[model samples]
Target: MKVLNKGLKFAPTKKIDKFGVFVDLQKFKRSLCLKKYFLKDPVTRQVLGENDGWRHTELKKKSHFYPKHLISKEITTFETMVLDEMEKIQPMRSQNLTKEEKEALKELAEDTTITIKPADKGGGIVILNREDYDEESLRILNDRDVYQRIPYNPTEEIKKKFDKYIQKGENNEFLNEKETDYLTVKYPKIPVFYHLPKVHKNLNKPPGRPIVSGIDSISSKVAEYLDHLLQPIVRKIPSYLKDTGDIIRSLNTITWEENFLLVTCDVRSLYTNIPHNRGCEAIKTMLLEDGEIKKEQIDYIVEGIALIL
Candidate 1:
């Protein structure tokens, strides 16, 4: 089975359109037939009850049965409630726009496609110069020189390393249509859509920290797998503190005095603002210095981390 689709873009909206929507029905059926199956197989029912998360609820209750009609109606009702809440919470675009302001927007949008903007009093129709915006953005980036987004083209070395571990039928267990149907019916996959992220400042009064968002261009499962491999290496680092518990242990012996200077410094946008290439180099250096982790493992892990950057 082909595991990784090379040309696959991590766009949930496009993927959903290309494939189809997800709907769960098997879980409902299982719930409905709980009593029927339990009566037939006592041992199997007992095992299931032990494994299942529910503590007090009897697995053989006919009254607890879930039917398609009832479940579907409940789901629909919940969805309606959600929609109503959303409508109540989020004000519609152009909701409070005056007649004159709307007319002005209409006149401005006559020549080109325009999205509905906020109904603020200060002119709803402000035309943007794309070229100017791009130039200014580039200038700001160049001036800061904080970090650069690297192109993630998987090199041959990296690909070979990944291919070595990811063999046929090892981790790449392709689900059959029947299995897929059952799984999808139990836990449906929801398509996640990307939206324009708001660029904002952290509330540090002296010097506000500029923060930007990154597009999640990689599959979450792939990222999680990489994270698991990297965990051991991260744990090996002695200087770095992992959690609050570690910090507490480290500071346990310290005694406060009249002349003692205590300080807490927060890193502003540490992850995203760090230089990607430099970070990869640092990881490689750390691994090489460790002398315990094999060179092959270090190279593979470094390459995987670099690929994500």
Candidate 2:
């Protein structure tokens, strides 16, 4: 009983088309008729009126429909039966896959000449020659200005420094015992480096957009805490726009003058090019100007930012 979005269409794979068990149309139609009858019956209406179900608390919510208890129970029972039947058919469906399609899929998975990845900006998959993908990724990674070859992994070194910082903060009463414990990283790994090709920029020779994922790095907890502290202040900034939607809303309010000029700017590799010292100083300035953040908290935040940078 898979419900697809309106206007959305998809062709089933050969294996799926042959083996998939869809809902019985007659049963589905009968269920719909039952639901319609249930809604229109006078007895059901009287029950709803007596219970004041129209003004029920759940009605105000937008996420899910809250049907009348009797209707809901009946629907649940019907669905359960359908699901049970589906489970019985599942084993049979797996055994009935077309051998040709199955073999093709297996061969495709094992192929070494090509790589498949989601497009950097668009909402579709992109297939590229495996050699080309590797070459492009390495070319970007080898850029001396953006990345450098390290002699050894710095995971333990970074973890030690992070733990020492937390211990020092706790000793100085800047952070409570619980806060220090929360910030401590039991297991930290070095950030993983990857890149997604910007296919929209150039399909034949797409530039790789470098990504350094630090989710499991030593500074992850500290970074998360710092972001939590800074979010409120960030939202209050006059020029802060959360996303394209925010920019659109802001643009709608502007009373354009004849002399006013609309200008746009794009910084190439903005994140990698940012000077650590200048970035930290900017953050410090913002933290200092913010009246809500205490001086001690600001100092801790600045130190954390410096460590992360």
TM-score of each: 0.36, 0.68
Per-residue lDDT tens digits of candidate 1, residues 57-131? 121112444434434556566555655654455333444566786686468667344222211222222233334
Error of 2 at 54 (Å): 47
The model with the greatest TM-score is: 2
Runs in model 1 with CA error above 4 Å?
1-216, 219-221, 243-253, 257-259, 266-278, 288-293
Clashing pairs in 1: none
Error of 2 at 109 (Å): 1.8
Error of 2 at 192 (Å): 1.7
Cand. 1 Cα-lDDT: 0.44
lDDT of each: 0.44, 0.68
